[model samples]
Structure formats: structure tokens, C-alpha cells
Target chain A: MAIRQLSVFLENKKGSLSEITNLLAEAKVDLRSMCIAETSNYGIVRIIANDPAKALEILIASGFAAQIRPVTAFAVPDQPGGLAQVLEILEENGINIEYMYALVTTIADKAYAVMRTDDEEKTEAVLAKNNIELLDEKNV
Target chain B: MENRKYYQPEFETMPVEDIKKLQSEKLIKQVKHVYENVPFYRARMDEKGVKPEDIKGIEDLYKLPFVEKSDLRDNYPYGMLAKPLADCVRIQSTSGTTGKRVIAYYTQYDIDLWEDCCARALVAAGADKEDVVQVSYGYGLFTGGPGLNGGSHKVGCLTLPMSSGNTERQLQFMTDLKATVLCCTPSYAAYLGESLKEMGYTPETIPLKAGIFGAEPWTSENRRQLEATLGIKAYDIYGLTEISGPGVSFECAEQGGMHINEDHFVAEIINPETGEPLPEGEKGELVFTCLDKEAFPMLRYRTRDICVLSRKPCSCGRTFIRMSKPMGRSDDMMIIRGVNVFPSQIEAVLLKEGYTPNYQIKLSRVNNNDTFDVFVELPPEQFDDSVKSISAKEASLRDAMRNMLGIGPAIHLVPPKTITRSEGKAVRIIDERKLHD
Candidate 1:
């Protein structure tokens, strides 16, 4: 299964970030996780929300260049080398992660990471082969 | 030094009193001629309650109605021509954005006078019969090429009618022929400098010593860049196809302002909104009245360019009135990169492509080059669910947009409302480029 993420194109202009959040706030859309990658003139805002469809609808209605992207979310031990362990598996399987961010979960010493890969299915297969607990849409 | 400076010493250094006398005489003659020959102009004068007898000279110029870009469109081809068809020898027109282009008729004498003005520009830049002149402005229909091509002939320079584009071939000729003078737009000069360096030719190896650049707006920043890169002195020439093309006025060695050929054309600064003449040095819309042009003489024609005029003493000893580089345009039209672009043109493109007109154009200068980006709002039904499909749609839209606009603007297919709800003013353009003051 795949978790949905919103990748938005934004010029590195003042208040563009707030414009996105303000619209989401008005629609009462809860943000699950988010990350922003920026260049000198432009930026890409990646976001995860509780209701992707409703959030996308509200964002698109406001006139943003927003789109949905399929990504993988999985449980990772929050201790030392937790990130390293997942990276080592992907590295061994020759999979490259485009970008990623994390969600703060309530479980002790455990957190969820959402990542995009070039080859989605192959990356998921290698992670699942190593007994990683992958979170689907319902769990997310 | 005096002989080297003025291409035509008599008019260029004429006393202010005599210059005024000539202007008044020409204005009187041109007015009566237009009234008798061109009914279109006569009707406009009549509508404004003005007659040819009422206009004595440049002072009475304000009494005449102003002609604009749209007026040319209304008249189309030869509707506004002041001379007979048999008398006209040539025609040149600007590539208009919407429907009909603004056409300018030229007689053999008109072309001669135009070349004389260009010759004055070249001589002002320190060129003479001994120098090799290469004209790279596009030929035919476009005035830049022919104006300078004819002017180079008048100056008796070994003329190279290279025309525009074919940059590699341009370099080969520049070096092979040892061309010492170049005439082109400032942007094309910059591009040529870029390509020349990329081809591993140093400025010293190229024989170009001076450049006469016009047909587009350029900044002091652009001037500095081109001068440094091309290793040549850059001069500005100003004109419009409606008012006899690129040689109406030109920069002298003083580099303060371009000297308008006041002997052949009367230059005025008028309030763009009110059509009232502004005092000298106050920036306003530029107006021109052809004093010597016979075929397509325009009276009080508004250029839409915002600029100021000065009569200060010049080191070059030319008494012709000077006009500052046009600061900006009064209309919605803007020069993007090197091409003229209008927001209305882009809006029309969007409508023609079945897209709503909700869009934003962003311009920025990154590392001395312009980056044009347009963000268009997609309809809710076209809500792309996948990145691949969305990118594919964007690519196709980009092709259509590039076809509409001369250059391809980076297209951003944004959601329906993300671009609009943010800006309170609904401002269509966001320019981040730092321009030369």
C-alpha cells in the first residue's frame, strides 16, 4: 500500500508558506507531516495530511501548483542508527531515496518515516523482505 | 575634432533661433500637406476643432490631436499615408501583437533622411569612411537592419549587411573582415558577446571598436556588461517604425542623453494620461512630429515611451536636443528578455488554449540573464492525480505558450486557487530583477 503526499511548487517569495498553511487551517485539515526543499528562486513543499483529498481540494481551490505523489511510510526504531538501518537496507538493494520526512508518533522509541524512491515497488519489496512494518493509508 | 563630430555640421550645430525657425516652417508645411492629402488625419484634426492655419509651428503643436498605437491599428495599411502611392518607394512595419501591424511608408528621400540620421549616430560614435561597419539588425520589414545598412553607406564605411542571427557566421565575418563598427540591439550585442567568449575568442582578437545598439530598451547595467564583454563603446539609438525607425535620435560621446534630430523631428514630453505637454526634464510620454519626412509624416505621434528631455551643453558640440533613455512604457506592454510581451497577449493565448485567464507572470534576473516563469491555474476537472501526467500536461501547455510568446516561459501548472487567494491585489506580474538606475 502507498501513502499520499502533496508536492507543491512555490517561488521563494515571502508569505507563500503561510498562504498554504492558512488555507489548510481554514479547512480544518490536520497535517500529518511536512518538509520543504528549497532552491535560490523556487521551492518544493512536501506535505502529508489526515484527509489528502479534502486538503488537495482546498489547496487547488486557492490557486497553488499542488499535486499528489505516491510515497512509502514505515515504522523505524527511534534509537541510534534507526535511520542508518533503513538507509543501509535501501543502499544494499541499490535503491535511491529522492527525499523524505518523519512523523512524531506516540509509541515510545518508535517513529514513522515517509520517503520517496525512484523505484517504489522494488524499494517496498526490499524493506518488507527485511520485516519492516509498513504503514498503509488506514494506519496513516 | 569639430569636423569629426558632426556628420551634418549646419543643422547639428545650428543656433537655437534658426532651429526653431526651421521647425515652425516644416510644421506649417507638413500640416497643410496632411490636411489636403490624408483624409484620416484631416478628420482627426477637424474632430479636435483644429485647422492647418491654426498651427504656426512647434509652439502650436499642442493644438493638434495626439496619435497613438491604436490609431495606427485603426487605419491599418495605407489609410494614414500623407503622400501619394507613386511617390512612396518603400514600406516598413512593426510586428504588432494583436491584429494589424503599424506600417510606415518611405520615399527615396525619406530613406535618405533616415540614413542621414543613422550616419550622424555612427559619426558620433567616432566612425568614418575608413572604418568597417557590420549591421546585424534583421533586414526587410524590420527597420533596424535597413536603417543602419543605409546609414553605413552614407558614412562610406565598408558595409557588411550581416543581418541578425547566425551568430557563428557573424563572428567569422567580424574577425575575417576586421569590422570595426557594429550596429544592433543591446540585447543581441550581449548575446553575441556571450557566444563570442564561449567560442574562445577574446575581445582583443575581435576588431569591433564601437557599437550602435537600439530597437529595444537596455539599462546601464546592460551597457556596462556589453562594453566590458565586447570591449567596445556602446551607444544607444532610439526610433519607432511609426516615426521613421531607428535613427530618430542617438547617443553622442557625452553618453548623457541621445541627441534627437530636432532639425527633422520635433521632440516633446507630454503627460501620458492628460495629453498635456510637460516641462523639459519632467518624465512623460514622448511625442514626435516628423519635420522632413514626406511620405509618412506623423504629427504629435505619441511614442508611449516614458522619458525626459534636456538641452544641456554637450562635450561633443552638438546642439540637437537630447532625450534620456526611455525609462518605461506607459502601456501594459513590457519587454521580456529581448522581445516585447504584453499581458493581454498571454491572456489571449490562455483563452485560445481553453484555459481560464487566471495566471501570474514572474520575472527575475539570475546571474545577469532573465528568467521568465508563468504560473497558470488549472481547472478543477484537470486536477492531475499523478506527477507524470501533470508534467506531461505542463510540457504541452509550455509548447503552446512558447508558440504564442516568442520565448518559452517556464510553465507551472498550479492548483485552481493556490496562486490567487494569496495576493490581495491580484497583481499579475512579480519582477525581482534589479535594473540599472
Candidate 2:
């Protein structure tokens, strides 16, 4: 199943992420899962918020370069090799993942993980064919 | 090779008095020619209360009015042409940097003399018919390629009009044809050298023996790097599209300073602020008076390049006066990778793109190459949360800048108010290269 993710472009400067968080806090938006990708010149903060659309709108209105995209989320056994198993299935199916991060919420005995791949349709199809449990936006 | 030492030995080896006499004669004749033909010069002369009869020789050159770069912009297309358009056969222009492009008209005779100057430069650089000359400078409207191309022909060398870029083909022809003389900007020469080294070729193994590099400022350190990397003697050639490109002045075997082609153009150093002529060997703004150019003859054109002139005899046996490599510019113009860039031009691009004019230019030299980056503040209204969308905007801005500047720079969209301003003025440029030093 697919859930929305917001990616914010920020300069690699002091207080940039803090300022963004402050703005989102003022807007009453909750960031569920987030990961930062850093480069020499700038950084990208990929986040899944309680209300992604609202968070994105507020970030843009506050003068931040941000965007929203659909990323697949799935639940795995709450064990050491849970992510490795999902990665193994995706690799065997030839689905290249651009990035992935773990989610805060999970089902009983299962951990939730978010993934973005080169071919989203194929990735979702392979995971579905493998019978791996997929989570929807409402589940996240 | 013809075993000839100089292209025009008579002019190049003339006595100091004879050179001055020749310049005076040409200046006197040129003054009357421009006064009679170009109304702009006449008006300036009239406004300054000076007449053609007053300019007897080079000593009285100060009596005439000095033409500034603004004057060129004020009279854009054909305003400064001393000859009619029909008589002009070619027009080479400076890469547009802010306002109107400065166009230089060239008649057939003007082209011939320009090529002759190039030939002199090539011969000075040890290029002859026996050497294969590869012209790597850009062609078409830019004078570096065409000027040196003609000069290579004049020198009777097997000329390769390779232009710029396409490293693979450049190397193929360079090695296959056994190119002995390479010509391009200092940075490009450095790149070719690095590429050659990566390809397992050393200076001893490379076929190149000499290189003519110019169209931008470079240091002796860069010269040493280019010379060692390419395994060739790197020589500096000086010129601008405003006053016939590439061969206005060039270095000889001595490599002390570039020798001005006094037989064609008269050189003078003047105080940048006061316009008073400075004596020889003192650094000041350099100026030129084209004595032979007919189509777009510029008289006492302020070059804005700060350098000194030397009359001390050179070991190279050329009696022509030598000009030190331009120390710095009097204006905010920066020669990045051999293209003129101005902060105002970058600011104009930002304003046109609906962004605030709050931007900063970061210039650095990495591995003997120039690295340029521009950082612009992202306005609140134009902020997009998507890195893809924002990166697309940056790419488009880079394309627009390349179209305007003839060189592309990495564009970064920084957060709003991040480009701090001091004293109500944003510090626009951060140059880490220390280019003037």
C-alpha cells in the first residue's frame, strides 16, 4: 500500500531544520518518520507526517522548498532480519530502492518500514506477490 | 620551418626611436581618418576643444579624448565604425556581460593585420610551418579561434581548427596528427593536460611542445602547472574583442611580459582615477590606440586592465614594448573560464526569474580550473517542497545564465534570508582564488 511522504529541501546551515520543525510545530503537524539525506551544499529531509499534505503546504508557505510523493509502506516480523528479508525479496525481484526508513508505529509483533524504489509499481507488485503485508495510509 | 626568427623582423626589431616615429606617423594619420569618418570621435574631439591638427605625435596622444567602455555601450551596433558596413567583412563581439554587446568591426585589411599579429605571436611562441598548430579556442563570433586559426595559416603550420570541447576528438587529433602547438585558455590547457595524464601520457610522451594561453588571467603558478602537466612551454597571449582579439600583445621566449605589437597598436599606461599617463614600469590602467585598424579603429580606448609597460630591451631581440600580464581590473568584471562575468548580469538573471536579487557568487580555482557557483535565496512564494521541482528550477536558471554568459554555473536555491547583508549591501562575491595576486 502507498502512503504520502514530504521531502523538504534545506540549506546546510545552522538552525535550518530547527526552524522548519518550529514552523511545523506551530502548524500542529506531527512528523511520524523522518530521515535526512545530506550533501555538501544542501540537505533533504524526507518525512512522513500525520497530515502530509497539510505539512507540505505549511512548509511551502513558510518559504521552504518542499515536495510530496507516494512511498510504499509494509510491516515485517518484529525481528533482527525483518528489513533484510524485505530487501532480499525486492533484490530478487530486481527492484532498486532509492531510499528507505523505519516508521514509529507498528502492528502487534510487526514493525512498519517505508520504501521508495525506482519502479514503484513493480516494487508494490513484487511485495504483494510475495504475500508481504502492506500498510495503507490509514494504517500508518 | 622557414628558420625565420620573427614574423615581421623589420617592425619587431626596429629601434626605439624608429618605433616611436612609426607610431607617431600612424597616430597622426589615424587621428585625421577617424575625425573625418567617424562622427563620434569628431564630436568627442570637438567637446574636448581638441582638433586633429593638435595631435602631432604619440606625445600629444593625451590631448585627444579617451573613449570609455560606457561610450561603446552608448554607441552599440555601428556607432563606432569608422568605415561603412559594406567595407566591413567580419564582426567579432565580446561575450555579452551586462548591457549591450561590444561589437568590433573588421574589414579585409583589418583581418589581414590581425592575422599578422597572430602570426607574430605564434612565431614568438616557436610555432612555424614545421609545427602542427591545434586551435582549441571557441570559434564563431569569438575571436580566439578565428584569430589564431588565421595566424596558424599565416605561419604555414598544419592547422587543426578543433575549436573547444569534445575531449575525445581533441586528443585523437592531437596525438594522431602530432600537434606541436596547442592554443586555448589556460584552464582548458590545464584540463587537457590532466586528461592526458589520466590517459597515461606524460610530458615526455606527449607531442605538444608549446601552448598559447590567454583570454583570462592566470598566475605564474598556473603557468608552471600547465607547463609541467602538458610538458610544454606555456606562453601568455593578450587581447580583447574590443580591440582585435588574442594578438594585441603576446609573450616571447623571454616570458618576462607580453610584447605589444607597437607597429599596429600604441600602448599607454594611465592613472585609473586621474587619467594621467604614468611613466614606464609603473602599474596603472592600460590603454590602446589602434593605429592600423580601419573598420572599428579605437583611439586611446581605455582597456581598464591594470598593468605596467617596459621599454627595457628584451633578450628575445624584439624591440617592441612589453606589457605585464594584467594585474587586475578596475571594474567588477571577472574573467571566469575565459568569459567575462559581472555581478550585475547575474543579478539581472535573478530578477528576471522572479527571485529576489539577494544572491552571492562563489568563485574558486580547483586543480587549475575555475569552479563557479551562484546561491540565490528562495522567496516564500516560490518555495517548493520537492527537491526534484527545486532542482529543475535551478537547472533552468543555469541554462538561462549559460545562454546569457556563454558559461554555465552551478545554481543553488538557499533558504530565504540566508544570504545575509551587511551595511544594507549584500556582499555579492566570495572569490577564494586570489586571482589578482
lDDT against the true structure, per candidate, is 0.84, 0.89
lDDT of 1 by residue, B1-437 (tens): 33377789999999878999999999899999999988888899999999999998788999998887777878888888888889999999774555456689999999999999999999999899889999998888888899999988998999999998898899899889999999987777888888888888787877899999987777888898888998899999998888888889999888999999999999999999899999998999999998879989888898889999998878788888999999888887766654567787788778877788889999986644578998887765565434455577778888877766656888886655556545465678887765437
- Relative to the real complex, the DockQ score for model 1 comes to 0.14
| TM-score for each predicted model, relative to the true structure | 0.74, 0.83
The DockQ of each candidate is 0.14, 0.30
lDDT of 2: 0.89
lDDT score of residue B319 within candidate 2: 97
Give the alpha carbon lDDT tens digit for every residue of B105-183 in model 2: 9999999999999999999999888989999999988899999999999999999999998989999999999999999
Which 10 successive residues of model 1 chain A have the least lDDT summed? A101-110
Candidate 2 stretches with Cα past 4 Å from truth are A1-9, A22-40, A43-140, B420-424, B434-437
Q: How many backbone clashes does candidate 1 have?
A: 10
Give the per-residue lDDT digits (tens) of candidate 1, residues A1-140: 88888867665779988888888888898887888876554566888888888888887677666778789999985578988999999999899887778865455666899888888899889989998888887777
List of chain A TM-scores, every candidate: 0.91, 0.91
* Deviation (Å) of B66 in candidate 2: 2.1
